[model samples]
Target: MPKKKKITPNPSGSQLHAQRISELMLEKKALDIKIIDVRNITTLTDFFVICTSESEPQSRAITDHVNLTMKTEGHASWHTEGYQYLDWVLVDFVNIVVHIFSKTAREYYEFERLWADGTITEVQDEV
Candidate 1:
């Protein structure tokens, strides 16, 4: 039997990084931005930024905007996944995990329900 790998929490830049990701998502007009504080629930990641783009193109745009903006602002993701499908894109920045999903896919995943125990904060979109 293979041993399961444990995910260590990265305390450095957790909040700041998550905040920046959320801000970028908002700037890109990602709808219903949500910040989930899963620090107490899981050690894998401190925070989860879940937001929905109107369509696949917008989903890609949101992810791209986040990547470019964060990198330009002196932060870069350690790993990114799900770009091929463009339905759900994940940008992992160690402590902060950003999820840019299409409307239908976002509803299907129901990440908010999966992490219901965690503190879920709704990020208001200015526009």
Candidate 2:
């Protein structure tokens, strides 16, 4: 078997963006917000912030909140996807990627399983 590559610590920018995204998700009442460092497994994105909203509307709201908050805070996304369906919304901030999904959709995709090797950090929202 080929040797496994080492996972580098997340860069400052990636961590900052991940925190910001997590905060926004919390503000929107997103459930189970998690930050996964996938830099070691794939270079496609440095970090992934996954969260689930209760419904389609909530999912859209969560994504919108993150996008608006980030832009207002002077951090704009490089691109965004899956807004039309509202089942899952992906906001790409270059270093950090935000995924806002409905509960069912989140379970179906199972991104956690796909990136099981990455370091998963649970982010809780203080009520």
Candidate 3:
């Protein structure tokens, strides 16, 4: 099969943006943060920022912080979903997508398992 075309408008910038989002997630005390690099695996997006919160409120807070922080960086989310339920909220930028999920929701979904082929980086801060 022919190699698939990658959608990398700015790989470096997208990586940096994903890092920033991870930082924002950390700021909100989101646990088990993982940034999955799916560039070589798929053309869906450059990175997937996944993090888990303790509860619904925590999940919403993480999403809000990421959304606002990204906006301040002059990068608005192209779209967002699952805000109504707060179990798993997705903040989508064109190059990076942030997943804010509650502990239960995250465990139930097991998103990382599905993307095991991708390069996964777990983010840890002393905060």
Which candidate should be chosen as best, given lDDT against the real structure? 3
Residue pairs of candidate 3 with colliding backbone atoms: none
Q: On residues 11-94, what C-alpha lDDT tens digit does candidate 1 reach at each position?
A: 457777787788888887889998898999899999999998898888888888999988898887889999999988999987
Q: Which stretches in model 1 have alpha-carbon errors above 4 Å?
A: 1-12
- Superposed Cα deviation of residue 41, candidate 2 (Å): 1.7
For residues 19-99, write the lDDT of model 3, one tens digit per residue: 999999889899999999999999989999999889888888888888888899899899999999998898889789889
Better TM-score candidate (1, 2): 2
Alpha-carbon TM-score of each model against the true structure: 0.86, 0.87, 0.89
Worst 10 residues of 3 by lDDT: 5-14
Q: How does model 2 fare in lDDT? A: 0.88
The Cα RMSD in angstroms, rounded to one decimal, for candidate 2 relative to the true structure is: 6.7
Clashing pairs in 2: none
| Whole-model Cα lDDT of every candidate shown, in order | 0.87, 0.88, 0.91
